[model samples]
Target chain A: MSLPAEERVVVTGWSCLTALGANTETSWSRLLNQEYARGPISCFPTDGCRVTEGAEVVLPELPWLPKKAESRLSRASRLALPAAREALQHAGLLDPAGRSKLGHLEMSLSTTATSMERIEAFVRQVWEGKSPIQQAGRVASYQAQQQVNDLQTFLGFSGPAAVVSNACAGGANSIGHAFDLIRAGLVDIVLTGGYDILCELVFCGFDSLQAMSPDRCRPFDVNRNGLMLGEGAAFLVLESESHARRRGVPILGVLAGYGHTTDTFHLTQPAPDGTPLEKAIRKALEQSATSPSELGYINAHGTGTPFNDRAEAQAFTRCLGANASGVRLSSTKAAIGHTLGAAGSIEAVLCLKTLQTGQIPPQLHTTDPEPLVANMLARPGALLEKNAALSVNLGFGGSNAALLFKTP
Target chain B: MNTPLSILSWGAVSPGGLGVEALENFQNWPTTVASEVADPARQHLVATIDASILPEKWRMRPRFRRASPISHYMIEAAAQALAPHPQIERNRLGLIYVSFIGCSVYSIRFYRQFQKDGRRFASPMLFPETVANSPLSHLAAELEIGGPVYSQIGDKSCWSSALRTAACWLHNGDAEQVLVIGAEEFEPHQLEAFRSMRWLAKPYTRPFAEGAGAVLLGKGPHSGRPSIVSLKDGFCFRSRNESRTAAERCLAEFAPNLPVLDSAVGWIRPVAIAALKGRTVHDGIPALAHEAFGASCAWDTIRAAQRLSIHPEERVLIPYWGLSQQIGAAALEGTP
Candidate 1:
């Protein structure tokens, strides 16, 4: 069945921070030139976290500091808050120097040891017989809403807020779900992105899954290892086109449409043949009302695992057929480690930047590509003289999602 | 664009309990214990599925299988819900699944294994299912459904909000049938963690009286019989107990003499209120709730399903609240 002919969803703003650089332009610029962002993960000592190496985003030393905030924010949130702040600025949803009406959404996996410390303290409190204070500490930390409560109390956002935690698809899923809130008029402006701090819980989880690459993730490459876990956040400001037009907001790209599905075949293994994934692409295409031929670029969910790249490749081949080669595709993970939940949004911002700049980012270390996607990867982030791009993401539990973006 | 929505057929395996029994046994459900998905392993099963039963797929190299029998409970619940619902074009139906705590047993297992000997016991296959949203995502894939599939993990209040989101999608012509599921499986340890954190009450039980419900929401009607009452409207409130007050607050303002089905929705929430409310209503079409089977996640949907045979004049208050302190209070109007 074809997509229902209806209102076109458009991208309004985008932002990202990755190993390629601290901003979308810088990241995509180097990405298009086939530069690799692989480096030793030094932000935290990766001593006991299993395998090493990742596309770790190098935080640029900010010369200026805002003197107002007094609370300690996790690194992932620090990355996300700024990117979201900037995205809203670009969309004119947030005044450059002031606050604005906005709904906030986030998709995250594990955060660092912040909660661990709190829980430990709570344990200590109970041991010391400070039961009431201990109870209070446990209540706040174990509560999922604490994150948003913290965000609201810190950023002063009075609008609607929701946190989505769907593993790898978290970021894109957040953006996709957030778009609905906007289209449905729940909110005029929204900030959708993802965050995950480098944490041992996550480290152990991935290690147990054997999904982590000992070396750099070589997505679509025959010699691929697994995935290099990365830490960072990405955000996008999505506004209704009518609102953007009236306010004359600077549109970065269109949020377009997204497709989400679960394979259900096995919770972890992708539908080895890619049936659900193929269906996901079709659904996304149908939702966006964009055609396979119109998609000029793709940010692949190339986690560099044996299963993911292969599954994604087969899914792409099924979705695009010969048109698959016509679209330039690359895995930003080659530059930045897979940000788990943040990968989708960060890559989305990069894809938007690619559309805005007309350059498809290049894939580095793509030797001996998977046969199915070999031809597709060879074109690695070629310029899209015409501007429509799609980002593909899949996560554990057989989730497969796709998003289409268009330049304004 | 409000695309026309066809109420595709629906199938469900919930604790008001199986097939037409769920609809037929709508009166004071005899027991508070929830009906669980029949365990396939323990039963002498005639394998009708021609497809090679890859049951072992759960233990794959990259294994991340949903633990706690509830994941599978939700799957069969969904399979049942879809089986009876209008078979919408597979291409257009979408799945929306929600839960409060995602798959915790795997995390529990992972932690125990690591604590035992980090490398010696790590099962790759058991790892991925440890994350939230895995079951919803997995169920869609397993169904081979080619529709827009999504999931949300919210506290009690978002239970109705999740439905509202599905309705909004339908209103926007996004899909035909939106599969809404709430499933949860508890690891004794996870509950232990909750207890340590004071999130739980005591030596906990599955609270089978609380969980297990799935619903297919679209524009159409059930095949054999007309609905007892079509769900009219629902709003979210703050807490389970607070939800009752929110419903009471709404119920107070409306015509007191009007026919209303007062049911307490939510898993393990405002527990004995149902019995108390049932006693208050006396013999009239008292109420329906998921208090029998431990709550698998859904709050109001489970309660709403119980009133399928109620009259059109009956107004159903489905107050589904969440752990996040958000409350949704909505009313379902029975129609001619």
Candidate 2:
């Protein structure tokens, strides 16, 4: 499904980073080779962390980022801005006039702890009910923390600045919301993206939930343990057709159609039935002009969790019909790790890259899968002749999202 | 501009008052004072009532046991608003909680822990709520609302943004109902500010106070209640004046008695003075409650409307201008 013809949002510029590469091209190349970013958790003091193995993203040691950024910037934003900067640079929308038309938008899940130690101090002092002011009085000495001033202030985001933070579907939700804003004649150009940084709090939470896999994340694999958490960001420059034509911006691809739906089933679990994902997929097609058969590749949320993969596989079959088995499917997490909040946005960048260069990133570590996802690991990043793909993301809140793309 | 949705049921907890009687007393009050969600402890926070025996209703579905008072007030108000519509299931409900700063204690805790343990140790229970959306996620999970959840941390307009988020869910037909909540207590910095001679010297001063508010948006089945007054077709305003214009346009049909709530340093009886201005309003008047909740966060707006349910046909609008002016207005359904 493409957007209601009148409201289709086109992708004019985009950039991203993951275990595969720090920049878009390098990352794409790494993905095709099935090079998994697994190694020691070198950046942080993982001696106290639960796991040692991670798809640790290698930074180029850019002078632009601060030494402390490894601790600050939440993995999501740090990953997001490069892509955003690249997209802006690509679309030639960095100038004064374009800035006005381009609105700033971000979908953030926990990429890093802005104040990595805020909670630990409270336990030391015992949460005294004496006014939060008093509590702060006791903990004031520990206040050497900083956070990005909500994308608007940090990036000088002028037009309609907003942050979307909805667990897994957040990035796609941000894109969908940006599409709404663009279609409704709000902003001509939309800098939309999502970011999340790896943090002990989020990691510990996942560990407690029994969702962390000891080895690399192998989505759809028969012996899947759980998910390996990763951190990164992705962003795309969205513009209306008229604006794109006027600026002569080289459209990377068109964000043909998308859909979002809430399962309303369980907080930590997807519905035993994949109705919500189906509804989102159907709506994405119905809202967009393209049919499911028109979709060349399918990026599965493929969290490697038993229920999610099963539900998602069934949902894919419902959408792709007889072509479900033929459609190219893979989970990039096999190379990178399950980057909770930033997964949606980063995958969007990956899908668009799939459109530009006709290649699919292999879902490494997935030699065998559950009966439902038998065909997911069959083909790695095999690019379809026509550049078009749909990426779906689901999260803890039973939130689901589907984003479609086509070559410009 | 999208016609702003008509507000149906609005409730608030501020220094001004709680239930119906307090709202009427507010209508004619001459001085402006911040509303108090609780009260300033005479001696390091002494408890007057047996909070232990007060049903402890929130404990049953507790997400964070040591959550700040602001979160406590938020849950109380949300529980009240959603309780009425029992048939409205929580599973499909969407929730949004917004604040410039959230339970600053938990934040302070996380920070202090980093200092003591060198960022190596953080309470896993508390870690989930440290993110801005923790409260929203906690609320949604408690209610088993497996729908879209969002949290925004910013100025006064956080509440309206959350409400706007809910309206999107409503417009998109994603959820059957959406709950929007906002609350924050004075941080340590402001608490120090309150202790200064400047705070003590306010001409019409009354010391520390708390305030908060909450509202719910449902698909339909509105029982003739004043609902979704307007759905203004535009983004929320940026500048204070721009916000005023947005407010004027959204509430154009329902002329509200706008009261200037002073968000400055030394506030007091004179602050109450701002609310007492006798303005002629067709539907209802704006009862400013700054003295009640001294920067209690956006919950003050909901409390303001809850305080306004007195006049049978009157509507209440609470506009807060801060870091960025976010005007939160609600049209309350007054019972005859």
Cα RMSD, model 2: 7.1
Name model 2 segments beyond 4 Å from true: A1-5, A60-80, A96-157, A263-266, A289-291, A318-321, A385-388, B11-76, B82-94, B101-148, B167-177, B184-212, B218-298, B303-318, B322-336
User: Per-residue lDDT for A1-408 in model 1, tens only?
Assistant: 112234444567667777777776676667667777667666544455567556666655433235333244435445555566566556666644445445333222222222333433443343344433235545445444455444444444533345566667777887887777666664555667775555555666677667787767788899898887876767787767766677676666787777777676776678778877787678778867788888888899998898888888888898898788787778878777888778888888878877777867677777888888777773553667656888888877666778888877
TM-scores, chain A, per candidate: 0.86, 0.84
Cα lDDT computed for each candidate against the true fold: 0.58, 0.57
| Backbone collisions counted per model | 72, 72
lDDT of 1 at B19: 41
DockQ of predicted candidate 1: 0.21
Looking at candidate 1, what is the lDDT of residue B287? 44
Report how far off residue B328 is in candidate 2 (Å). Answer: 8.7
Q: Give each model a TM-score.
A: 0.77, 0.74
